[model samples]
Target: MEQESASGLSGRAGNAEPVAQTPTPDGAQIHEDYLARARRGSIWQMLAIALSLAIAAFSIYVLGRAVSAVSLSALRQAIAATSAEQIASAALLTVWSFLALTGYDGLALRQLNARVRYKTTALASFTSYAISFTLGFPLITAGTVRYWIYSQAGLTASKVASLTVIAGVTFWFGMAFVLGAGLAFHASAISAINHFYPLINALIGVSVLGAILAYLVWVTIRHRHISIKGFQLELPGLGLSLGQIALGVIDQCAAAGVLYVLLPSHAELDFFTFAATYVFACILGVLSNAPGGIGVFEAAMLKAVPVASEEALLASLVLFRVIYYLVPFLFALAFLGAHEGFHRWTSLREAMRGSEEEKVLEDEINPLRRWYRDNWRLRR
Candidate 1:
């Protein structure tokens, strides 16, 4: 038995090859690095959120001091005092603002060399912004909506992402351009914010404009795509960037005009001054990320428009949300519902047509079967 076993082992050793094991250790090391980086990113996000919350809290406290306590009746009186023309003008501006929003996607598509119909782009832009402005998060709301809409229009995921980034940058560029113009022109506009000297606002505005200018210069000179991490960024041409700036200006102006119209003319608030304050307040609200920037936005708006009484301003703010944010959100929901209903109706009609065709084909090929079905099934 021992001799037989020895012979078998010797044959096996001579003929057998070394078995190769999968290199799991190297893969494990790579996975560990990915996890580490993800954790670090999460930590940074948490820190940023915390910071935003702190700022929001401080702003809320300051705003509390600026206004006397208001009651429901007082708010109603303020609303009652607002004129019909003011309401209509504000609504009209809100409509124009949303229309300008569609241009963000339009201009972005041009930059990306992506061909999509203006109608599709308008739907995507309108619905996405309508949802995101209220939901208070772009990634979850607008980004997902864009992905869904753009994908059906033949845009790949990366293209959609690029489109989103470009469109977002366009809004900021416009905001910066307008804000810079507003502050540079009117230094004392929103001094209540940060208690800073008027010169600081002007300087900040210049810095924002300078940053946008620098971006344009870089795009003009390099004329090359930038790669960061694994994503490729194709910057728009100088002329296109200028167009983006124009879109932003129009959107911001319409948005600010929404409130400007709502305010009492006696408030003595001019467009440029209100635009500066509105832009500043908007930035604060965006940074806070509280849903609709609820308290933070109102506070900033109230603080910036010191001429308007707290109760009257509160009424305007309420109307602004209803017209600008809430009305559009409802309309978006209605549009989505109608779209889904239409698709469902189409599917059902197609299914019925398909069944009729199959039935006719079956009857044509098998008269005996059809007769049996007609007699037996009908009798049963």
Candidate 2:
């Protein structure tokens, strides 16, 4: 009967012959566009996964060959020979690198106009990178962690996604800047790895820098925004863009310094030259999608950075992994666990308090209800 009445009322209101609802022309076109985009995205994702697997497999092969010649006793002695001062320097650089990492998320939030607290942004950035660096598949691990924290701070999925994209751009910008400058200034040194003419390497560096200059000029002239699948993302202005690059450079340099300081005193490579090699290895490691770029980075570093004592270099790499990657990863896990527990306890307490207040209100209302009922009976 209710359904019939509702149908009759709707029909009377229309006062015309009923017509079946169909999607509008624009709506249908939009749906088709979305489907096409999804199909393309899936294809790209598959290709990326296949590429990562290939890189990882090749890296593992390279690593196996490299380590076969290494002597365990020599490696142990090399590690023991590392001075307390070198360890202290590397540890300090690691701390500095992570501090710069926190700026990535903080700057990203500013770009999004999302007014989250610095501590909150720091927590998200540090924890996400720490977990993702050790776990592999940053888009999954880092994005998940960022979303988990940012969601509670009033950021939507789209906003968090945009923030992640912006932060990634910051990192790449810094990398390109570092690589460009290093290659331009010391192309001869880099030629040892690439076997290219110094002039050619310098040209490549100049080209990269030129591209960055072009982008800066373009943004300065007008506001730039990207529209991907109907979502609009505003680009940071020239000043903020510069800041992003600076922060990236600082972070990458600090990270590279950690490994550089740990290397044996006999290695004797310049900081700028070593930084270029470090960035290159790090990039390949990232592409391989292996946890902490395990085999890939070590393999690349071994191949690029020529040292007399491979065992000593390997020892330094091991210490770098422990201080820069493993320690932070463990710390982040414990911190995340504690944060989750505290949040749950706080929520439970709030819920109990709300329930208690409701119960108290009900207790006070019961007496008034009885009084009103008795008065009503007398009046009747």
Candidate 3:
């Protein structure tokens, strides 16, 4: 490669292509493959960001209309009606949910051929999800947080990118798993979509499950990486795939339960029934990229549970948001502050240690000079 570069620039200066280049399978220069893929990914990411913003705006506008019709006094009464046991139960479920989320980063690290201490992985995972869950752009919010933590720990930007992609796939696997089971087992549970056609809902559930199975079987058979644009999904060993699915299932269910537990006691909703609506609403929220899926999630939830009184239902939604979205967001900010403080303290300590070592060396080699320097500083 150096020989060709020199030959092309041999005693001349011009915008000349390299006289020699390695041809790729598609006949483009080998370097072009990387460039092409990067460009493709960048374009797609920009388009997605634009679409998410639009959806969020539209959702918020629609939600404003729905909210205007509800009685504020009744909503307040409904919130007051909630029991301490329910709030405690819901918050405990949130802890379990975040614990499962930590596993996502660990599994992604395994898939991306990287490793970090469990504590570091937990910090990154929790901070990212806590922020991104409210902020709505995981790529920007969660991806940046992961890069900051993982890069400092020695992983490169490219590997962190792959890790984020894998973590996201893990989420999908769980969502699909839960959705399929709920739909297949109890198509009538989801009040939002069941009214359209129960049979169709079950069929959709089957298709979702079938697709997940197909992916696992295909990867096992092919035994090759799946690459698209600039990203590659490394085919994990069968055990890792199963573990990812489990993590997703647990994480998704626990998160759903956080909101589910807040519903009025008399509401005719079972876990499976509420979870199906919850998952679907959560999907809409994610796709909208609305902050905390605020307007979008409430709209979907209210639409699904029309049987419930609006005032009581609205209060439950408000409490659910406080528990699942707002609280974690504030806590994540606190964690970030503490992390920064510790990092700064460590840096200061290391700097002081280096200075002390230098002073000690001077005193050993030239005691008089060291003494004078210290006395001068003290005098100053």
Q: List lDDT for all candidates, in order.
A: 0.86, 0.90, 0.83
lDDT tens per residue, model 1, 229-262? 7798988889998899999999999999998888
Which stretches of candidate 1 lie above 4 Å from their native place? 1-43, 63-68, 190-194, 227-229, 364-380
> In candidate 2, where is summed lDDT lowest over 10 consecutive residues?
261-270
Ten residues in a row with the worst lDDT in model 3? 188-197
Question: After superposition, which runs of candidate 3 have C-alpha atoms over 4 Å from their true positions?
Answer: 1-62, 231-233, 371-380
RMSD of 1: 10.1
Ranking by lDDT: 2, 1, 3
Tens digit per residue, CA lDDT, model 2, 136-224: 88888999999999998899999999999899899899898888888888899999887989999899889988898998999899999
Residue ranges of candidate 2 with Cα displaced over 4 Å: 1-54, 367-380
TM-score of each: 0.83, 0.83, 0.82
Residue 186 of model 1: what lDDT? 72
User: Candidate 1 or 3, higher TM-score?
Assistant: 1
Q: Global lDDT for candidate 1?
A: 0.86
RMSD of each: 10.1, 13.2, 10.4
